[model samples]
Each structure stands twice: as C-alpha cells, then as structure tokens.
Target: MRSAKLESMIPAIDVRNLKKSYLPINRRAGGKTIALKGIDLTIKSGEFYGLLGPNGAGKTTTIGIITGLVRLDEGSVSVMGKDIISDYRFTRSKIGVSPQELTVDWFFTIERLLYFQAGYYGIRKEEVSDRIEQLLKKFGLYKKRNSKIRELSGGMKRRFQIVKALVHDPEILILDEPTAGIDVELRHMLWDYLRQLHKEGKTILLTTHYIDEAELLCERVGIINEGTIVVEGKPSELIQSLGKGSIEVYLSDCDPEKEALISGFSYVLEPYDGGSRLVFSVDEPEKSLSEIIKALSSNGCHIHEVKITKSSLEDVFISLTGRAIND
Candidate 1:
C-alpha cells in the first residue's frame, strides 16, 4: 500500500482510453456488442463525482471494469497512482463498491455478514467490531443487527449494503444507484449520509438515474452516451454551456409583425396557446428579458404575464443525449 501522504497528491482514480465489448451469447443474435468506446475519466481525491447516462450507455460496464468485476478489452486504469491490474489487491483494497444488485448471502445475519466481509479484506473481527458498530448505528441498522439478510426491508438492505462496503474503510467509495427503489425519506437519508462521507474525505464516484440527485450532490459530473463520455464538468457549468433557459411571455393580442420581429432574435421562438403566448429558448434569459420586453413594448405589443425558467442538469443531459436519463 502506498503512503497516505503520497496518495493524497495523486488522483483517486484515473482511466485512459478505456474500451470494452461483450461477445454475443448466441451466433444468430448479432456481432459483439460494444460497451465502452475509448473513454477517459479521472476523479480527484475527496471529490464527489457523478457518472450519469441512459440505460445501455456503458455506465455499469465502466463501474464493473474499475471494480474488476468486468474485464476491459483495452485501457489503463489506476487507483491512487497504482495500476489496477498490476496492483490488483492493493487497488481493490483502496475501493469499496456498493453495486446496484443485492449480492449478499441470504442466510447470514446482518452482523455476521459484515464480519465475513471484513475477514475477506484480512481484517480480524476484534479489529473491525467497533467500525461495524459505528456504521450500523450511523445507518440506522443497529436495531436490526441480529436480523437475517432475508428479513431486512428494502431500505434496510440498501443501508446494510453501504455498511458492508464500508466495513474495510476503503478510501474510495463507488456507489451504483445507491438510492434507487427506495422511499423518498430513505433516499434523503442516504443523501445526507453520502454527504457526511464526502466530508470525511471519502472519494465518491456515484452513478444515479436521478439527475436531480446528481445535481444536488455531485461537485462535478460526466454524462456518457453510447459508450462515450459526451460531456464532463461542474453541473452548473454544464447547464450554462449546454442547456437553454426559456422565457414564456403571454401577450394581450396576437400580431404577425411583432412575432416575426421577435423570431429574428437568436432565440428559437415557439408559439403557445395559438400565438397568445410566445416561448423563447434563450441562452441567457436574465440578460435578454429586458431587451425582449422593450422590443415588445416598442412594437405596441401588450405583455400580460411572463415566466422564466432556468436550465437544469436534466436539460443538459437531454440536449447532449437527445433522450431522458432513464431512456
């Protein structure tokens, strides 16, 4: 293992020209399916980064490759400045992954399962018992410590999965849809817990279907599409660059000349409510609003009401991918 002081100077995870593909199970189905197409990504230590993409966009494949669950056809991956392949045990020890699927043993009790997981990382029960108790209490799972895995609720199981991942106290935490299929309260709880973990200097790589979650939690985000990363930046920066804000103006009367003049602006104008309203997609609505109002007033067009909408992370995702995040 590298020294903590030395590891802090390098990136938590780095990938270069990553490429992966899966062979067809049946000959008649088709040729090999490409999962990742030469993607490059880097995550800094103690940063909360989000990896977002639609289904079949290679998000899962990328996570799998980094965690060593799926092999990459071509690429180089390093964790804490060490090659993942050459330093498999060291790199794996540095990361704690909570996958979307439930892969725990059904028969084991919650506490027992955690003990077994700790042992896998060469941790003795005596050395990890305090950490296990702390995690269980922090995640609200201490009450059910004696419950079997099969007896836990969905939310409880999700919490246990996170606890299991943290049993070894890895530096990097990779969470794949950590809040999916859970209630709103539980989801918010997990979000808070993740934030706490981030504060504690955990390098978190999150993949979530919820764009709002990514926007709220991630300091920076990368959106993948069709095996490639289309965009990567701060969520606000991405929204400002790739997303469009809108201004909807309701008019007192419809006039062809005024509408034609408004359409000449750089914004894309779409008529709403049979010309009674105009929806303009503008790059900067706040800067353009007064100009638009003045233009309308000078043209003798009466304004009834106005509504402005700022761009969001979801809008950026749609603009880049041409589809919703869930699609």
Candidate 2:
C-alpha cells in the first residue's frame, strides 16, 4: 500500500540517456570533451537526494541541464511530469537552485534582493512583501532585511541565497555546495532548518563535497564518476557493502609471513608506516578478530596493538572511486 501510494506521486526530477559534451574554443578539431555519457537517474517527490562526485565528474553539467542553464545535447529531462524542453517555463518554476558560486548582486539590500527574485517569478505585488518577510524570518534574516548583501557575514550571505531561492515557493530545491564556506555551527543550524523543510514535504537535490552532510541528510545518494553514475543507494547501505567493520593491526616486527596471512583474508589490505601497520576490512569483527589474533600468535608473530572500527562513507567512496572526493 505504501509503495503504491508513493509511486502515485510524480518524480520531482527525471533524466534519461543524458549526454553532454563541450568543445574547447581554441581547439575546435577533436577537442570535444564529454561531460555526461548516457546518464539515467530520478529523484522522487519529497526525497532528499545527494549527488556526489569528484571534480570534472559531470555533476555541474547535470545540474546545469536540469535548471535550463545549459541546453542538453541529447536525451530528455522532466520536472513534475513536465518535460524541460517542451514545458521548460513550468518546469523551471518548480525548481529553485542555490549554486556554489555567490552569484547574487551585492549591491542590493536583503529585502530588495528577495523582492526582485519574487518579481521575476511574477509573484503578485500584494503577496510579495509578506512572503519575503516570512521567508526572511524562516532563514533568520528578517532583522537584516535592509542591510546590503556586502554587510552580512559569509554565513548570513549563504543563508540569503537559500531564502532567495525559496522566495519563489519552488516545489524542488537544488542546492550545490550550500554549506561550503560556513563554519560547523552554522552548518548544523542550516541542517536543522533543511530537515524541517524536508518534513514539510519539499523535495531536495543536494550536490556536495561534504560526505558527512550527505550521510546525515540525504535518504539516497548517487555517486558519479567519469561522466557516469557508479553507485546509488542509501548511505548506510553503501557503507555496509564495504564490510561490517575495519581492523587495524600493528605488529612489533615486520614479517612477510605475517603480512601474507593478513592479506589472505582481506581484499583491501594496506600497509602504513613501513609495513608494521596492517589495515583490513572484516565481515564479522568479533569472530574474525579472534581468528586473526590466534593465527598471528601461532605463527610466532608479535602483535603490538589491534583496533576495530566501523566503516564510514568516506571509506566506501575511497574504495569505489580509488581516490578522495577532493582529488
């Protein structure tokens, strides 16, 4: 019953067979670089979805195509059952994007900036002032309504970008690195507010370098690489796929015999600090740890220390991507 009810609601964003490429201005002959290669994905209504990838991973291109900023070279994109190409006017209205760049006009006051945005969407004059005030209060910016964008702190400026996006009352909000430059406290505050918004039934598509933030807020995540999606699942599920936990063993002596025994058990064993440290993943930590310790002791290997820890989203990313997000 629940699955059927959920399916009854149209997806907020859908892209299929998406392909985009760019040609360098100086080198027109065979200098084309593909951004998105036959990508297919969907974000359902009222879901907080995270899109994560390294730089040059087609994340920006995907967002650009959906927001109607970049024209797609192939495939189709739809928002709320409306095709972006055929019904872009209506599709764009349903989405509000907060880009990574500070693209707002710093000359305008907080109040006027929001009003200007609402005006672009053709919001009624009578409804404009009241709606702006309400959104400002919601984002803790009502007191700075008359303050110019330059006067506000970086955190406040970031919050205003969100308020400006919401001024249009969009059904789906797309935030690209929304909390990039903000401090930890402000990030947590914004997280709480975003959770409240999600509870109110707003669909969100977030692309961020902060893996921890994605793990905390998003229900599902899609990790893209080399112009294609490599993995898609809930954060917990993805981390679970790596293993139950990780075990780091520090040996007193570096022995090839001991190294071979540890390597035999784990597919992902790394030697750190001159082969004395052996880090590997295990499916059952309790059973595996006992077995590993026994094998080492029986083999005349001296074990100095052992530490078992749970796998994190970062570990999963590194395992899959073969590199870090910042790389």
* lDDT at residue 36 of model 2 (Cα atoms): 95
* Model 1, position 315: C-alpha lDDT score: 90
Q: Looking at model 2, which ten-residue stretch has the lowest summed lDDT?
A: 254-263
Candidate 1 per-residue C-alpha lDDT over 1-327 given as tens digits, one digit per residue, 9 for 90 to 100: 578766677999999999999989996898999999999999999999999999899999999999999998998999988888999999999999999997757687899999999999999999999999999999989999999978889989899999999999999999999988899999999999999999999999999999999999999999999999999999988988888898888876647354555754554445656556677778878988998888887777778889999999999999889999987
**TM-score for model 1?**
0.86
Please name the candidate that would achieve the greatest TM-score relative to the true structure.
1
How do the residues 14-94 of candidate 2 rate in per-residue lDDT, one tens digit apiece? Answer: 999999999876784667899999889899999999999898999989999999998899999999888998898899889
- Candidate that scores best on lDDT: 1
Q: Please, what is the whole-model Cα lDDT of each candidate in the order they appear?
A: 0.90, 0.85
Candidate 2 residue-wise lDDT at 256? 36
C-alpha TM-scores of all predictions: 0.86, 0.81
